[model samples]
Target: MAGVEETEQVKGATREDTQAADREPETLYGISGSPGIVVGRAVVLRPRSDDLVRYRLEKEAIQAEQERFQEAVDQAEQELKDLRSKFEGDLSDTLTIMDSHIRMLRDRMILDQTANLIEQKQINAEWALSRALYLVKKKFDHIADEYIRDRFADVEYVVNLLQEQLSEHGQQFPTGFAEPVIVVSEDFTPADTVRMQSEKVLGFLTEKGGTTSHTAIVARSLGLPAVVGVENITERCRTGDMIILDGYDGRVCLSPTMDQQKLYQEYDRQHRAFSEELSWYIHLASETLDGLRVRLSANIEIPNEIEGVTYYGADGIGLFRSEFGYFQQKHLPDEETLFSVYQDLVIALDPQPVTIRTLDVGGDKLAIQLPGNKFKALHERNPALGLRSIRLSLREKTLFVTQLRALLRASAFGRLRILLPLISLLSELKQVQEIIGQVMMDLTDEGVPFDPDIEIGIMVEVPSAVTMADVLAAEVDFFSIGTNDLIQYSLAIDRGNEYVAKMYDPLHPAVLRMISRTVEAGHAQGIEVALCGEMAGDVFMAPVLLGLGLDELSMRPSAIPHVKRLLRHSTSRRLTDLAKQILKCGDGMETRALLDCYLASNAGEWRERS
Candidate 1:
């Protein structure tokens, strides 16, 4: 909370005039949610809760309260739509993020629960909103996937906006800024990021968020510097305090010295330039020095993300997360809706093959959406290892059939592949194949046009799948190794849990061995192997994966150029030798040491241009 001391004395100010500047400077650290750098005056914005009054509503007034809630939701949706429309051309990424928030605003689960509570409890709209939010948070709290759990932030932000509107306080940002200022808040949703873009906000500092948070993702897309989870930034500095937001390192330096400001300014300049330089690799091939070509693809979440894939010159969409449709919609998307979305994506990619994974949700994700009154509580003590993915689909035949039927119908439009998620045992894969055959037979009998030769693949995430990779590879057309879940299951460490995140290592000898085994087995069967996981995007691990003979690598679109750039400068012979040595190592630290040594020796070539 201390302020930085001025290195130079002011021309006319006395010692009393510089009392605030005399305090020692403090540097707060957090996760680098978005990468860039900026120095600006800090504007601490806190949500207004003063006008939130709680009073019981009479039975006759319940209808009015419900209508009031609807009005507030509508107002919030309009504000979001207007804000999203401002960024059209180069900021399409931001638009997609805003779409998610808009969907959250219209979620039937939230609206119905809030309205029901208002009618049954005879409480104020605010009270009912709080109760509904509590229900959503309760479900998220039990989620095993950390990324999915972060979605709860969207619910909180949407409810907050609705409450602000209903209270008639609306919302306000600090005004009269003489210059661009860094906006600091307890949290910033995607909507907040959009709002900041309309103002003179240079960057942002948040007390709570993660790298995968929608706010952070939008910040990166906009090239805005942002650091989140900095703990008590609002209390540390007042509005207009000079601050340096080091988004690359996730450091917030309050009241920086004159010298520090200049150094950061230069760093910021180089960072922007480096980012531009990486864009040059967008149209280049991902080929090693030995002339081996590796397929680089994009792991997309939404249909809109296809634009990014084309811009980045990705070979195709390696992983289309179909579950996102379920998450974004109020109820389940019908077969027609699903088919249309898939059709669009495949048509956009055209010649490049699109691999679509089926609906992969269980426990925390799907159970939360089921009506509490209709369905019994769907509980799982450990959702990650419980009935999920292929297992869940097998149990719920109709849900699985609808998705398969839609996928089959869409296959006629473009090159398509079906990917099964979280497949552990051979039996699970076989069960899925049986269902796929039945669907194909039904379509055949009905004279519906569909692609019968659509390549079927399985996601090798669970350890059992890795152990039985040879047999599983024979059962499927290909294998896509999901290293994130594999690492978690292999090491028995939940990366989502902060306490044990340190133990979650993808470079663990066991994990690498599983990858190597899977790739070899798939290749032995003349089937291609791809990796669609966090590790695939990580340039530092690119050499190892390539050397392990991965046929394809799929990642977020933004990461494609960096990974391709790294591959272009690398030699397969050198990488293969290093990987061989790494495989001989006993532990992850040893393997990491080998990798670091290689990178250090070849820094001149491996490092990206500025």
Candidate 2:
């Protein structure tokens, strides 16, 4: 709060005018890694690249250089082990991450390769390590999974540690700050983030990271406001510069004016007040005023998020993206590894159904190892419409069967359901069932314990699936509408493409029809219907989804309270009528107008009652 420096008053100019003229505000946008808002002075952390220098070594010095590299590796391992020791219990996920780093340090791909490079190339220890990192990064780049490719950051983190040790940089991070500050850095590792103290660090602004990166995961766990993937953020910001971080909108404002600061202060106050109000609804049941009950579940990517799910009062986990385990490590996860992860999740939330969606990676996104341990990338003109999801699973039966075995084995622990992604044909469903049956028989022959009556479901995303929903519904136990892809595929628009992004609207009549028809088809076959997508989490779309006869809504943990509060205040009959009116509209504009009018009329009543 006291970071903004005031300029001396000039002749005929006010202090505010002088300060405003001296400092110009600049804004940078990036991906929202966590949620919160903070205003503080920036504390920039220098990148490790600054300490890296490549120099040729004499042939006789190669052996000593290799020994130096080995020493650095040893030091890095000891540092990680010491850090791991600090976290002893209940923080199993954090410990697992540390263990992964430790294993990576000793891996032949990194350890052996760097040592070999130092001797073969006759280069300094720092240069050999950097080259080894570059080669390993090339392999990571070949990985089709974005989440898996991001793990390269973890490798970089290890290398950074070794680099620091090799350079003899005493300590890269500051032990303490004079006042609370926003940390701006080229990137942060889980190690760096774990070492941070919330009392001294107000937020984080980084140049590299994704929503699923380890750094982002740690930031969320720490309840820090972070905006990552901003280009040149470290270069743009300097120490002690006044800054405001808006994690909700992925924005960073540097050198803010008085008006901007005041406005953001007011916004922060309102957000805090609204959060306090929502806390009151966390323990309430998700049901309409007329007593039409619906399940509110959370969609999580990793096991560490289980704490947030329970804290947010979710009835269960609606959608667990299971592919993270597949790419969390260097090699494909074995059945036992998968089972361990799945079992932990099931046992933690016993009696509450946890719906785990199978691996949804393939098409242009698939990076598989060919014979001789070579990585190959699959080429596809249109990955979304190409060989992905169910198709890939069927083609790779060995992979598919392995996952089924893990899922079934974990079922014995607690409530678990298997949700398949992108099932467009009845044949795909049948093939999956056949494989499941064979796997179950094999498990029985092996005398492995598992649940015999495990429920199976499919994601209704493509238009073909919507058209054949009634037929597919008869085969599965439940239906989860993936509106994100449904809307995109139905409108022939790629939401990620800037050219047609504005055309991707969930309120479009065709999108609503697809959802309505899928719900009807599922209900006709006596199966429950749930919506798990971006639409389900939106408070504005809660009434519409409820009116469409969905039995459950799964969303991010943070959105559960607001959506539940909206649903609890409205009656089913009113929402159904509103849905019917909107469906009759001819276009997206008309539908949105009608929905907005309804929400406007009832918004105040809902708030006042709350």
Candidate 3:
């Protein structure tokens, strides 16, 4: 935290700075939060933390200052309401979050507490307000559940908005663009990104964030090029400077030379052309030239992502991450709430099968009720390999049973399947099956209607699951490879740790062999094998997955069209040959080279256009 530039870093494109630079054409490195290329003039955003002049208010000025605070609150509430109105049903999660902020603004606790602080301490409104929020955040911090505690960030964001409103220094994004421009910031919330999507913003560069940040997720959803965690970017560049952003490589160049600008422009053009070509396959089914069909599905964290599913014409919802519901709410959702969501999703994506993954909470994601209410909070040194996913679910039967009943009840409405997460052993699969059988019997006894023949599957993530895929395949109806976790667990690398992220490779010989083995084992038992993870969404790996004879590939809904395009342009036989050659590679680098060669040789149109 010491080396960091500041806390709560959020700035936007500002007017041109007159100061001279120490060096021209400087390059900064960051994580590729989103993928694309853009050449544009830099617009330095107003600093997120402007110097606040905190001063004690005389007792006589307290009432007037309180009125000023109320006015700021009213303005912020109205802004949020207006923004919330702009989004529709498909963005229900964001809308819900916005609604929460509005409610917070209206909450008497915050207002009354701040007013008391102002009257008692004879402090300025800003100081009193900051103290009030700190007290509230302290309460949040004491919450044993990490998911609930992390909501403090939301509170911090709300406080920032109010402070900006009161100071009359809030920056509104430009609605029009004379030419494309890059928006550099220290950070952006999901709401910020959504608003920017309506403007002429070409890409995003931030001093803080990661792949799983909400800003990153929103950027990916909108298909914008973004780079995050570029430390001290604001110190190096200014508004109106020529900039080249290579999102594919996570590089930002300031005051780029003409030759470099031209090179990036061509790269940008190629990226756009490729995206345009992918759009042509939005309506087409995912199939190779040899007529082998592949089921292309979507992975969703919230119910709202169905918009992308409908937009891309995905075959179905393959991985509905049910744990997000737990994270979003203060308390565990009741059976009815879960049932309603699952039912609505099935109705929305009707006819197409929906594989709802049972709550896969733990390891960077904590359940709201599990740790504090049902089980003791864990302090494990290695929770990734500790009690998580099915392990946690089994230990908390009431929680698991409630979700199972909700899922079973919802299954009556549409083509729904239950997929267990992080399964590692035949015994775990057997125990889960036994519990499902008992739940189904109870439901029947109570005359509760559900899909009597609903299929059950398990995620093949742990190395043990892959090793025993043949045995596990015999028990479950299907297998969905959670490649993100599979790669991490197999390679013993923390994917979230930027220091070692490069070592987390899905194309590693061990990982691919596990996948190939899983597919073979599942197919041998006449069970469908699907991939529902980040790897499934990657275009470079789509053909390799297909070549390995996967029945389905599930990824972010935004990516389905591109994968479909790649599939449409390829042949199953050619992909099989490529896979065979890749399987023989000894390391990830060799495997990557083989894949690159295959794509370059086969996708001649892309090559020529580039």
Cα lDDT tens digits, model 3, 241-335, are 66788887889998888899898889888888877877778888788767989999998877877877888989999899888787555457899
Each prediction's Cα RMSD? 4.1, 5.0, 5.7
Across 253-341, the per-residue lDDT of candidate 2 in tens digits comes to 99897789898988888888988999999999999999999999999988978988998999899999887666556677889989999
Q: How would you encode candidate 1's per-residue C-alpha lDDT over 321-390 as one tens digit per residue?
A: 8987877765667889999999998899998999999877873455445433322355767777677788
Model 2 residue-pair collision total: 0
Evaluate model 3: give its TM-score. Answer: 0.81
As for candidate 1, its clashing pairs are none
Error of 2 at 220 (Å): 2.1
Candidate 1 yields a Cα-based lDDT of 0.82
State the weakest 10-residue window (summed lDDT) of model 1. 1-10
Q: What is the C-alpha lDDT of each candidate?
A: 0.82, 0.82, 0.79
The CA lDDT at 427 in model 1 is 80
Clashing pairs in 2: none
